[model samples]
Target: MSEIIRRDPRREWIARNRLHPDHASVLAALGVNRGGAAVSEWLGPHGVVRKNPHAIGFIGPNDVKRIDRSGFQQGGQSAATTPVAQDSRRTVTIDQPAFLVAVVPDLTGGRLSAHDKDLLGLARRVADADADQPGAVVAILFGEHKGEGDGELKEQALGDAGIDRVVHLNDEFYAGFAPEARLAALSAVEREMMPRFWLLPDSPLGGADLGRRLALRLGERAATGVWQVEADNEASLGWRCTARGGAGSLDIQRPLPRVALALAECAEPVDETRHAAEQLTLAASIPTTLSRIEDLGQVAVDPAGVALAEAEFILSGGNGVKEWGAFHHAAKVLGATEGASRVAVDDGFMARDRQVGATGTWVTARVYMAVGISGAIQHLQGIQRCDKVVAINLDPGCDIIKRADLAVIGDSTQILAALVTMVEQQRGGQRDAA
Candidate 1:
């Protein structure tokens, strides 16, 4: 990413599609009013922008200029910083020196006047960004409910990493799901779930729009597809968003809480066991609500539980790694877990959970092998912590290459065949020695 793009990649963004989940929802989450109703509910058989008066920005701070004035991680870039959300914002004291948003009542009806009063109030708080850890990593667990473990790993990973706090919303009041459809259905179940963040985990098309509506409704600045998780000496948090390398990366030092999406880079899930029942047991986070709509029947999900997180090494397909059966061979070779991507799932490669990205899983492990993925920003965001990353791509310029320690320019179909044999040979040798 050029330095210029890293700082200001949104020009192409502003000029493009509102249907984009990342950009649209992120800005929406940040308090920009895109102005409209849900596209799916509004658009007719033809695709067209529907202007709806309900379209509004999030609950800006009681002041506007102050927020714009106090900007970025260091609070300098005031050129354009948006508002945060009313998605049940919270301010808690966790013994760490950190800025606090004390949860004020957003009286603005979840709308912001472009550059208004409540906004400036938020800006004034920008200086409070770095309350404790200079480079603290903040993680939020969304789409949660009580009695079930939907946001389990998210909570565990952050905890295992020793991140300050794992925030969970009191309920799914602010879930990215079609709220109008099943508000009551989820509300009862989410009561026990602690959701530090309210998110829309819907499809990419609806995601951006959902975030936008959320920002407008909540009045916060929201950015989606966050690739980097770093803690600098700023307030709130600073995430390496996909916007990095394109537009300058975001330094959300603004008082407005930024809405961010973690890259679910089909990396391995972590296997940190939280001792329960005085015994070591496999820990899993599954959202279970007694009130699920029985009339609708079973919700499709990944029933197979594999030890991807436990693997010392993982070899799998990204958007690439085509030719169906090759996936099975790769997994069998290393006694590894197998999974696919959103594209892979769409093309009948694997189930949904097997798919990875901001909408999927985040993994940190020893070895990462990529075949066929173009290395889009979203795919590579969650993978920085890998001890070693090997990229195999036909396109040499894929973004994944920059992040990879080793690069292999080749086709994964053939590569997988060779790798399977190679891995088996090495494993066989290790076992023989043992």
Candidate 2:
């Protein structure tokens, strides 16, 4: 017998509209008429198809209707589904703030560093502690920023990081290692804004130096290695913080001061809310001071010789790696520090200092690439703070593949050779262009 199916365009559209009032009912109705009352789909209502899997079928042995686990019918292939995109961040605007929480972030390489983002998150916490009299998070950016797109896009980046206001110091005087000029500019900001709390990332060769000098110049006893901060009634600033002392051997809990230096991962980066990062300007011009220090440009340093804990990019090899020379060449071409799994270290393929695991030195690299390394528990623990992990392995089901943001399933030797060739070609092209 030939069966003719009647398609209702209105019902099909309703089935596709998840937010419609009668969407569930329409969807159920459309899904109940397919073969064995299982997989049902509505095709091209408005150039869009929607599928709904149904549990309606012949009763099983247990006298219960058999549920179709697959999106397709018993003998039919399932259509591909496109994931719906959703933006969940709430937009926040602080027109009139009771106070301001000033954050001076070390925009290393003209972008917000991980440590800088963490410090901003901490600042957001401090600013939003008292909702009734909520303060605003004001970020003070120095120098010209790059790689963050145009001016509007750059402000959007700051907005996404929970910055309510931005004070950019992009003058030539503030450029380079001009602590004296920067200190003078910060002093002007303090006088003009009078921010409630001043926060900075306690990172070496970045915010640490400037923060200490700012604290000294202002004569405000600053909290140096602050990791945790909480609102407290007894505290002068209405907050208390836990800081590390004695070379990170002692934990000291005290009242939060006006000026504080925070460690990396002091708090999670702001993700739930977006703010209006409105531009702000200082009323008075900063007077340039005679600098004793000469501004010599950046010195070239080899990435492979950098300490594992401080390395930003790492290329790690494991037991599956067959060609050590190719691995080293890949690391060199990629400009990444060298790291190795416990097995590779034990086999004497990599030095003991290059070992990466819980037993080895903990690494906080921005990008950790593992070639032929099946991720071990200890190795995963060591790179827990890394921003991204790239895995190259023969087995797609390897533990490292599960942790990797990008996984390439192939032979390690071939992958390394290919990567080196690609990098060398790009460099050669760049040289020719120059």
Q: Could you report the Cα RMSD, in angstroms, for every candidate shown? A: 25.6, 8.5
User: Each candidate's TM vs. the true structure?
Assistant: 0.30, 0.71
Worst 10-residue lDDT window, candidate 2: 74-83
The total number of steric clashes, by the backbone 3 Å criterion, in model 2 comes to: 0
- Quantify all predictions' global Cα lDDT against the true fold: 0.44, 0.86
Best by lDDT: 2
Question: Candidate 1 at residue 388, lDDT?
Answer: 72
- Overlapping backbone residue pairs in candidate 1 total 73
- Which lDDT tens digits does candidate 2 get at residues 353-375? 99998999799898999998999
In model 2, how large is the Cα lDDT of residue 252?
95
Worst 10 residues of 1 by lDDT: 273-282
